[model samples]
Target: MAYQTTLGWSLISSGIVTLILKVLPYDSLWWGLLLLVLGIAILYLRIS
Candidate 1:
């Protein structure tokens, strides 16, 4: 129950949040890469 509500739901929510951030006006491509990496880290932490 905790995994379903916390990890699963948080992953989905973070994905949407990142998607919105991507659509925002950002001049730096580096930020996008950082965000992608951070997303991966989140998934890794959750699964581990």
Candidate 2:
């Protein structure tokens, strides 16, 4: 239950961040990659 909630929030937050990054004029490839890595790390930590 808690894990599901965490995963849901993480996805939501990552989506929002991705959208915001898309809107910015600056290059976001690195930022997006960083966020992806961070999100994966978070999920890995939660699972273990």
Candidate 3:
């Protein structure tokens, strides 16, 4: 149950980040990659 909740929140947060990146005026590969890494770290921490 806890795992599912964490996963759901992570997914929602990632979705929002993606949406924000798309809405931004300029392309930012570095920022997107950084956010992706951060998201992965969050998930890893939650699992551990």
Candidate 4:
């Protein structure tokens, strides 16, 4: 996949996670951080 495509998908996934976090009442720093890290990992794997 192209760089833009991979980045787009990663952003979309990350946005979805953010949206879910926003929609839910539970607020925790770890969940957001974890999702961000997970997104970055996926992007790295895709690039490699």
Highest TM-score model number: 3
Candidate 1, residue 9: how far the Cα is off, in Å? 8.2
Ranking by TM-score: 3, 2, 4, 1
lDDT of 4 by residue, 1-48 (tens): 699998998799778877888776666577787777986898799999
Deviation from native of the Cα of residue 37 in model 4, angstroms = 6.1
> CA lDDT, every prediction?
0.79, 0.87, 0.85, 0.81
Error of 2 at 40 (Å): 11
For candidate 4, which ten residues in a row score worst on lDDT?
22-31
Number of colliding residue pairs in each model: 0, 0, 0, 0
Tens digits of per-residue lDDT, candidate 1, 19-42, equal: 877777774367677777998999
Model 4: CA > 4 A from native? 36-48
lDDT of 3 by residue, 1-48 (tens): 999998999799878888888887667687798778987899799999
Clash pairs, candidate 4, are none
Q: Supply the global lDDT for candidate 4.
A: 0.81
Better of 3 and 4 by lDDT: 3
Candidate 4, residue 10: the lDDT equals: 72
Q: In model 4, what is the error at residue 39, expressed in angstroms?
A: 5.3
Pairwise TM-score winner, candidates 1 and 4? 4
TM-score per model over all chains = 0.45, 0.57, 0.59, 0.53
Using lDDT as the yardstick, the better of models 1 and 4 is 4
